[model samples]
Target: MKDDEPEDTGSTLPRRQLGRLLREAREATGMSLEEAARLMEWGKSTLSRLERGKSERVRIRDVIGLCELFGTDEEKTAAIRELAEQAPVRSWWRSYGDVIAARFNTYLGLEAGASELAIFQPLIVPGILQTTDYARTLDRQYFSRDTDEELDRRVGIRMQRQHIITRQRQPVQLSVVLHESVLRTTVGSRQIMAGQLRHIADLSTRDNIQVRILPFRAGFPAGIVVSQFIIMSFPKDSRGKPVEPTVVFAESFTGDVYLEETGDVRRCRETFRTLQRATLDDRPSRDLMREIAREHDSER
Candidate 1:
């Protein structure tokens, strides 16, 4: 099999993992895709798309039918159905066409579907939580030549993406550790920075989100600096293994980086833990946020 081929070991995309499970169950019952589709009253193409991960969407009722047809255990049936429900929702980001780089979108899709996300940002706020004004200010300062329309659209996409934290039945659990300088840095006007700090404070109170600050006093124990990365973990599958190996996303000036190998994940996780240890707890972080807000108010 090709290196990128979906593994039957259950370490793959949700759809691919589900497909492999379905294939296993069907074969155990000596049923083909056509036979199974017919038994479930689904179109042949529908089953084909599902098996290929081209269409990962499925209803609980359909899962029930498959379970009954294949005589699958209730546990397996439940896990498969959950994967279908947890498939990443299609978003307007898709409309960006080729403008948004593929690596970025791939990470976004993983973020949208992740049950939990952990990030360590040394220089800036995590993108999903960045305020529109802050995002625009950063874009303007960095890309002065870019048209206003382009900037606005980028900011709009970012705001929409933030919904991943708020709109879901169980909002994605987010734990972010940002460097202390991020709070002190004036990305926008003084007023905007103050507003941004207050916003961060508000978001930290959210039940599913936690924000911490890593002070410079911690020094560079990990031998890394000025890098931001996120780790996404998917819900488990029928076999009780994580659906996909954790994916690490790192951004650069010109393009992005995606790390899926085991060694990279281990190093990123270690770095995250190291940063976590150096950071203030959530309560203290909130206090720092309020302090910044007060400073902004005083300057005003």
Candidate 2:
């Protein structure tokens, strides 16, 4: 395989990858799920659910057992084990369970394993990079059942998700474009907004993260519809094909919609390019953020 060839990280879905890897290893050894379950002393149905990625959670012990039973080579075993370790203990957005929302959890799952993310946030800051204060303020305004604890939990998860950028192995490339309105709008108090803007300025300095701001001067473009969405891409598989379909996630007040068809993907890419053309470049965007911060400080 070429040095840049993407390994079959098992499942295209991050949450399901571990289970799929385990199943593949077991089957390669010509063992049935029941046989593997017996070797591991786990219930057959439990093993089956994991293989199907239907389980809500994955256990480390189960991963170790499957690895041993299948006698998987070191590389494959290590990859599967890593996925098992990286799996979230619970859905990050579970705190918002009472809210009527889309299946954002699935999106989060896919994002966890994505190689790159291109985001266009026309209304507000992207959730993964929002500071705690901004997140809490936005959550309170949007969610009716909000509480201090829930807000804190959600914000904490958002912060944790940012670690995907700094993680040792394969860090995700993040390119984000925010509307100029996002910088001008104060979601929280003046002090909080200033801090948030400063945070954005600092984050833009990171090598793996790119930030741009779309100016209002670029009036109603074809892409400036009422919707906001993100496009995610993963590394290609052994056959030089994307393991999972590239997805466009569009969010509404009521719920979210995911588009995976070829035409939709093309449209999303074209819209993103148009939005990029409308945006200020990175240096100017950071300058704009700093300027906003100064304005917020002066108002106080």
Candidate 3:
């Protein structure tokens, strides 16, 4: 990657890339965010959101003005202009906007760019690995206000995201640690849970995917007591240099919290290591999953 050119970060999502560019340009000007917002006649929150890649739409004219203010050269300015123009185009998830949370939309964008995903689930299956029937069952129970159409759309989004793991081109490396309770809990029905377990077993066979079971005998880690979380890492640039920093995602009833600080990321990584030490290896984990699936099938 060229020094001046933005690193690919494996993120083809142009809107996010555009946001990073704007933030970098502002910093190069050595102006505080408040000062820049004042000069641009924009609210501080708006500018902050734009810089953080939270905004869904960015104005091309504003990009031009900001590029000029930042003293960016003509060639670089034109490139940024093009990104701004493309930022408003709808991503595949845009059509499901009404069904999913706005915060989740941002997560989806980052997930698409990430090269590796390490997830730990204590209560249930992660959305990325959930079957359609299982997803529908969970969504219907949790989103009581949603109509059937909305529920279907939300499940569709989850199902589509699984492609990141199974797709032929640029498949992501996935490591999942599931608490044993996840297999024990009946999600939709005996049949549904059985299918979900079988699906997980199938996914574990893939070369790029690793699944482990954290049993009850091995006490739960303090770090995971808060809730389930996903840690995502983006690929290096063409020159094999680090591009995007690792991100830790935790979702709650209110919204999602993303931790990017080096210290925060270190803690999460360490916690994962602790969990891994207590987990059943892939082979045993697969066997246990199949065993559980058999129990569910018997009940069905």
Candidate 4:
């Protein structure tokens, strides 16, 4: 990291975020990725990976070249370059590479510094809110090919990530909207399911956390085809501007997709608002969670 650059007090420090800015700059200049690669006299894949943040390291000179080519101002150029310098710093997630998906590593980097996280789950509970036993069961089912040790590591990581929700310094504002069915589904065992529901209910009481439940009677929001997704927003900078653009993160069996376009993010925000309108508020949601937990306990 550059000595002069201010400490990363928000989610924008990730190389992925820096790459996004560079990509946007290139697009704003009306230059194609291929055209820019040719103009810079670099291989097309190198430029592609750098812009996509797949490249492990980014050079300050390359960032400067792109900034100059894109006609960025001094302040923006400096911000981008500083992120490049921090790109190589190993994060806590690095140790869990054996269990974490390559595509998810970027999301982890972004999630840690997000100022707000809104998640919509149509099936299982969001991993960030799962209890250790609940997470272990889900991980084992999803990553069936992994060994026991890998499953344990993956569960550990999920639990650790929950700290962001209640962190001492600027805890992330968490808003979760869950489909009613998610509470009804039995993951590991009836006991585990009961514990998980109770845990979420407990978290709902925290000042920074908000939990809502969308009952089946409410029906699905129009134009939202995905089963689950998360929208993460970063805090404002010293200038009172967003540190980074809002990102909507969706994951599938294949890989993770991050949508940073203004239109896409706006639509997602709208969908979340619609769902929020149709769901039970925090108090009722917590009551429903306890009610479901009791159901599970009775089943056990």
Candidate 5:
């Protein structure tokens, strides 16, 4: 990283998507990055950066040269070049700055672009569905060192992401599956939990949103514990092919990981399907959520 090089505040999704496509195409031709670089008469690091989507600028001619070299079909080359052109565009979340971690910016971009999403939560509510108060409660604990203003901005971003699900045009088709434990788990207080449960129940009624709950009686699908994961699929292009591949997001205490390979994504999809079979139906899940919310309300 050069000292004079501009900082990457965010907005690398298109570049990252381009890089992944190019990398996959290159591998399909059975050529190593080093060999491709040598063949293109470009430095190895230059090709490496392009492949990793870490380059500051993506040149149209550069993409064309590589596509021609790899013998990529004209249709695919055009799509890949379009992605290159979009690489430098700014993302809305970039305005929030360090309030949003650099590691998390990519997921935000993917989430915004997703046409359909499958979210699984074994513990807490997913961020897009979290109410303002519920979000503040979680942030207050995790970002305890930050000033109130900083925390407010943090929560603000959470609320902004919800727009992708709520927009009147092209809203994401969202499916959320929660373990029954999430409804029972007390967050902040009984009152907060009541609001959160009711919130999910309300949102479940939307045409684009489906909420299902996995009960304890099901005893874990396949008797194996599954961590939280989100599977995001993109819209198709004029050719009826995905603009970008399906991506599976798995978050942890530290950094996150994205699974993009066909087999891995299929496995996650199957896992989600298996879990869905064990979950209560739409009406039943809403009933359970409301039932729990009432129990919280009745509590002294």
Candidate 6:
């Protein structure tokens, strides 16, 4: 909030993620913040700001210093440095600044950096799996007042986000569990719904993607309504330790929540597993969606 240290909302998520990681590493060594800063030749306040995620900028050298002091392993240290590097890098989603909410912006960054995404939807198709017409229809409904051009831009953003799945370099692994209602519920029109369903089925054939549908006949897991949510985890180190902590994203009518704490992530993860267990296997799920899409086509 200081005059000299202006807000950097664009890279907020990565910076905060980096800060949390650094704080955790320091705590593991039982080093007091003051003592750690002193050893690193950094001002106590400077170190405090980094740990609290208020630093205007993050320095790679400073991050490396802390990693060395904490005796972090090579792969882990490299991962930490990568976070520091990403702290200031602006993401592509920022181009749609006018349409993106602050919280959703945070999600875009996390989604871009994540190595794996596990999503559960009790309603319509998740944005990542949504086709242009389907996304355009939803956007038109939600942004009723917006002009056609604005709506197109919004739809464009959603379509671009799907690229991460198809990206050639270490494309993210995606596991999605959709409620049968998602396929049964027609979005824009029967045509749109059919196309969307087929698109999902096609994508499921990819090596990195798995889409499953939980039928209503299967019953809700534990008779509780599990709303839509996504659990994203970052890439791992050579030793198989996660580079960044897993985060769970839950969206509602009002806003979005990011759960980064260990316990909350664990619980959401278990919930996803429960939903997954109640769903059809990957191949069956893909076939089922294709069949449903054919039904929608017949309706048309």
- For all candidates in order, the CA lDDT equals 0.73, 0.73, 0.78, 0.78, 0.81, 0.79
Clashes of each: 0, 0, 0, 0, 0, 0
The residue-by-residue lDDT of candidate 4 on 34-70, one tens digit each, is 9999999999999988876667667789889999999
Q: Which pairs of residues have clashing backbones in candidate 3? A: none
lDDT of 2 by residue, 141-170 (tens): 766586888777877888888888767677
* Segments in model 5 whose C-alpha atoms lie over 4 Å from true places: 1-104
Name the TM-score of candidate 4. Answer: 0.68
Q: For candidate 3, what is the total of clashing residue pairs?
A: 0
Q: Residue 113 of candidate 5: its Cα lDDT?
A: 82
RMSD per model, one decimal: 11.3, 9.4, 10.8, 12.0, 12.9, 12.4
Q: Which prediction has the highest TM-score against the true structure?
A: 5
Residue-pair clashes, model 2: 0
* Highest-scoring model, lDDT: 5
Q: Estimate each model's TM-score.
A: 0.67, 0.68, 0.69, 0.68, 0.70, 0.69
Report the lDDT tens digits of candidate 5 across residue range 1-300: 011222232325566767877887899999999999999999999988887777898889999999998999866786677667763532311222332233235577789888889999999999999988999999999889989999999999999999988888989999999999999988899999999999989989989999999998999785699999998888777756665567788887765566665566778888999999999999999999999999999993
Superposed by TM-score, candidate 5 places the C-alpha of residue 91 at a distance from the truth, in angstroms, of 23
Off by over 4 Å in 3: 1-104, 221-226
Which segments of candidate 1 are over 4 A away from where they belong?
Answer: 1-104, 143-147
- Better candidate number, 5 or 6, judged by TM-score: 5
Q: How big is the positional error of residue 99 in model 1, measured in Å on the Cα after superposition?
A: 7.6
Error of 4 at 166 (Å): 1.7
